[model samples]
Target chain A: MNSVAFVIIAIFTLAAALAAATLPNLMHAALCLVLALLGLASFFFLLGAEFVGLVLVFIYVGAVAVLIVFTILLTGRDSREHRGFNWSGVVIALAVFGCLTWAILKAQSLTIVPPHIRALTVRQIGQVLMAGYVWPLQCVGVLLTAALIGALVLVLEEKR
Target chain B: MTPTLQAFLIVSAGLFSIGLLAALSRRHAIFILIGIEMMLAAANLNFIAFWHFAPPPHPSTGVMIAIFSIAISAAEAAVGLAMVIAVYRHYRTTNVDQFNQLKG
Candidate 1:
């Protein structure tokens, strides 16, 4: 059952990712990206990280995907099909994948099965965030506020 | 047999490579941003997988880092998209290759 689910999710994710990477239409690519993100969220669930999975769906699919689509729409004038594939980039990607796969396969310790463990709950996550990770949490809050303001400033119309 | 750590790592690697391809090959700035987001997601998956496969007594470190990573990626996406819009407004084009003003 576990292997079957993993296979299905992996196929779904990789296919959507390929589409997003290679699609000529910007809008279609953006939508495919959402699908791919959904797949990743499911993977997070499969790994027993329910809270992280929910956050992935909320932040990535809900917010980031919408932002990407909106950006595409806002910059729709040059929405024509992209130019031909950059073959050199394809070569580089393939080369990188080959090296990574080789390295992962060579590492024998990675063959072990996942040990059964209790699932992490949202309450515990909150506890950790407010305790051990308090400083980072505060820092992220400040960073998000800065990013929000900076993004707004960037897109704001020039007053000249 | 159930999927092992190697399997997850391989999948993550594949996702990362695909993302690199998108970022490197795509002409549009938005596609590049999508690629970057994909890469970040791949990294998050790695962290979670390792966390799950670790010994019986698990620390919340992996989950915590993943959460933080998600927040950071969200901010990154917003800022990146905003930059794309600003560049589009100034240059009237989203093709990354055409933004060569800084080229020596």
Candidate 2:
């Protein structure tokens, strides 16, 4: 049952990601990206990373996808040039895929026998985030604040 | 067969490759940003999968890092799209080919 769910989620994720990448319409691609992000969240959940999964949905699908859509609409240019297929990109992507697949296959023999899975509670994660990881967490806070202000400054219309 | 770590890696790799292609091929700046987001997501997926499978004694490390990446990517998207909006306002086009202003 778990494997079945995993397979289903993986298929959805990969297909949506492919669509998000290949679709010419920026709007459609953004929609596909939402689907892909949702599928990835489910994949994380299946892997038992519950917090990360929820964050993926909330952050990626909720915020990032919305931002992309707004940008597409604001820019008023959603269509790609009608230059047919971009063969160079296809070739490069295929080559990269081939190399990565070969690497994965070769590296399979060097796997460390995984220790029994350890279940981590959100409480532990929170504790560590506040205690051991406080500095980086603060840095992220500052980064987000700066990003918010910068975005506002960039998009604000200038007074004549 | 059950999904293994290798399976996850393969999926992540595929996602990353697709993202690379999109980033390289797409003319729209927003689409390029989307592709970059995909690549970031792929890397996060790899991190979470490894953490889950062979986590160190401190299991939260992986999740924390993934959380950080998610935060950073969110910031990235916000700022990136804002730049896109500004660029569109000035240039009236989002096509990468048209932004060859610095090309000597």
- The most accurate candidate by TM-score is 1
Tens-digit lDDT track of model 1 for A1-160: 2899999999999999999999888899899999998999999889999999999999988899888888888999987656777889899999999999999999988888668779788889888888899899999999999999999998999788
Per-prediction interface RMSD in Å: 1.0, 2.0
Model 1 misplaced regions, further than 4 Å:
B102-104
> How high is the CA lDDT of each candidate model?
0.91, 0.84
CA displacement after TM-score superposition, residue A1 of candidate 1 (Å): 6.1
RMSD of 1: 1.5
Q: What is the lDDT of residue B43 in candidate 1?
A: 98
Score every model by TM-score: 0.97, 0.93
Q: Chain B TM per candidate, please?
A: 0.95, 0.91
Deviation from native of the Cα of residue A54 in model 2, angstroms? 0.3
| TM-scores for chain A over all candidates | 0.96, 0.88
Model 2 TM: 0.93
